[model samples]
Target: MQFYVGWSHSDALFSDYYSDCPTLVSAVSDNQGTLKRFKNKPNKLIIDCGSVFYVKQQKRPTLKHVFEIQRSLIDECPNTSSIRLVHFDEPMFNKTSLSDQYYAMERTLYNAYEYLKVVSEEKLPVNVSTMGVIQGFDRASVHYSANELKKMGYRFFGIGSLLAKNQKQQIEFIKYAIEAVGAENLHVFGVTGITQMAEMVRMRVASFDSTRPTMAAAYYQVFYSNPFRTYVISASRAKPQSDRLGEPLYCECPVCKENPQDMFIPSPRPYMRLRSIHNYYHLVKTIEKMKVGTEREEVV
Candidate 1:
């Protein structure tokens, strides 16, 4: 299973672990500015250069621009294997023209798939995954778009925008689309709760990204201050991983069990210090537990 950790803006915004850790990293980009910034990072990282669609809803640019961006990254970092092209679709109500929105979406999706299929045939390795995303606020529309893309030779699928709120619905939709499209790999955008992880894993969805462990580490330091209030705030961000009454327990991770309350500090700001030395120990340990099966004796 390929674990895709998505960085919302730039890969630079994430901690050093993203650049150094072997876990796969996916980054979003709409323009060349961020592409120039991140296409050079070393590590066993695989980038998912997001959305080829423009926001203005005008005449789409010639397909040459999409190829150029892909070509630029390939030239700079030949090791980058997977390229997940996202498609940001506008809501039906907001669109300037309603003339065949479905047809237009299908055309763009086909064009993007055809562009990558051509590249794969010539220069890229046959195994290099060119994943496509379905962008829509509604689950049904997203599923429909994903199915259409699959018909155009896309095997992997991505879901965006709708995930931040209706994660459960996203999971259900992806499950149906996976069966419909015969998708081997599915990625859910912008969510990584413990419960959500269990569900995704069961559904055999390839990967999902989240800053939950990092956020949990930050919550640990503040929990002791006003345990109830801190738990309330942190719970809103991500569900608790363990049962420890608001202490932000990390029982599944060995480092947390060993270090306990010293895992993080709150002197400065909570978010900035989330990746501090102590927090990293637990964070890495948590990741290891998630990746490698932890023995009872080790975690206990």
Candidate 2:
């Protein structure tokens, strides 16, 4: 399984530091210039239409406009071997009524069809594959959404708006999607939980993305792998949500090797970035361990 780290324009140097990192960037957040900053590095990238950014707006950009933005970002990464372009989808987060949820699902299907049509007409390169976004509220809706996208010739599919759901619901919806489309090319969006990550691996998901490392670092929390524990930075004024750790653990990551103390300093944004890098390293290690354990079980 591939893990794409959610990226931001402020962390443009991330690719330079972690050359092997697979990254996901939002078209609404990062522009072509931001992508160009890491063009020399050949890492896998996912360019997603920032539907969540426009979810609250009464008016959203046209499909053509958003597709153009995604295309422009794709152009900046000629060296990137793999690029997944996700269609704009109407998120189902705030929709409570059945009618509202139905409308969101319909809008998402419409966008998927139109996006595929545009991709065909534009003749996007083979390396640039389009992912159909699946938006639904229940098992039946989820199956219907996935089936429609499959009918539209979407080999790569992603399910989103799951951030609002509980873990059991999230896993159920994911299973529904896999049942409809299979797990070979299915991607789960915005997954952060360790248990969920392990479940995705067990179920053989193609990929998932998260910004948890950076988000945790910004909140003055640090991560350590192996046993997979989190701690609050000792110097941080933020109330300890987890155990407080004054010193960094033994890590071979560039940030830790250079100056482990940088992670403990919570003031400057650069320090936070360093902490995020360290946290990301541990998260990646945790995923790798999970993968290895899963593989060994299968072999046994």
Could you tell me every candidate's TM-score relative to the true structure? 0.56, 0.94
Instruction: Give a tens-digit lDDT track for model 2, residues 1-300.
Output: 989988878752567777788888888744556776774554798989888887767888888888888888877877436999999888998899999999999999998999888888897877898899988898899989988998999889999999988998899989988988889879999998888888898899999999989999999999887778899988999998899999888989889899999889996899999989888988888888888774333222
Kindly list the per-residue Cα lDDT of model 1 for residues 106-178, writing each as its tens digit: 5556655666666555565432456666644344666777777767776767655443345566666666656
Name the runs in model 1 displaced over 4 angstroms.
Answer: 8-46, 52-63, 76-114, 117-122, 125-127, 135-144, 211-300
lDDT of 1: 0.47
Scored by lDDT, the top model is 2
lDDT of 1 at 176: 63
Indicate the TM-score of model 2.
0.94
> RMSD, model 2, all Cα superposed?
2.8
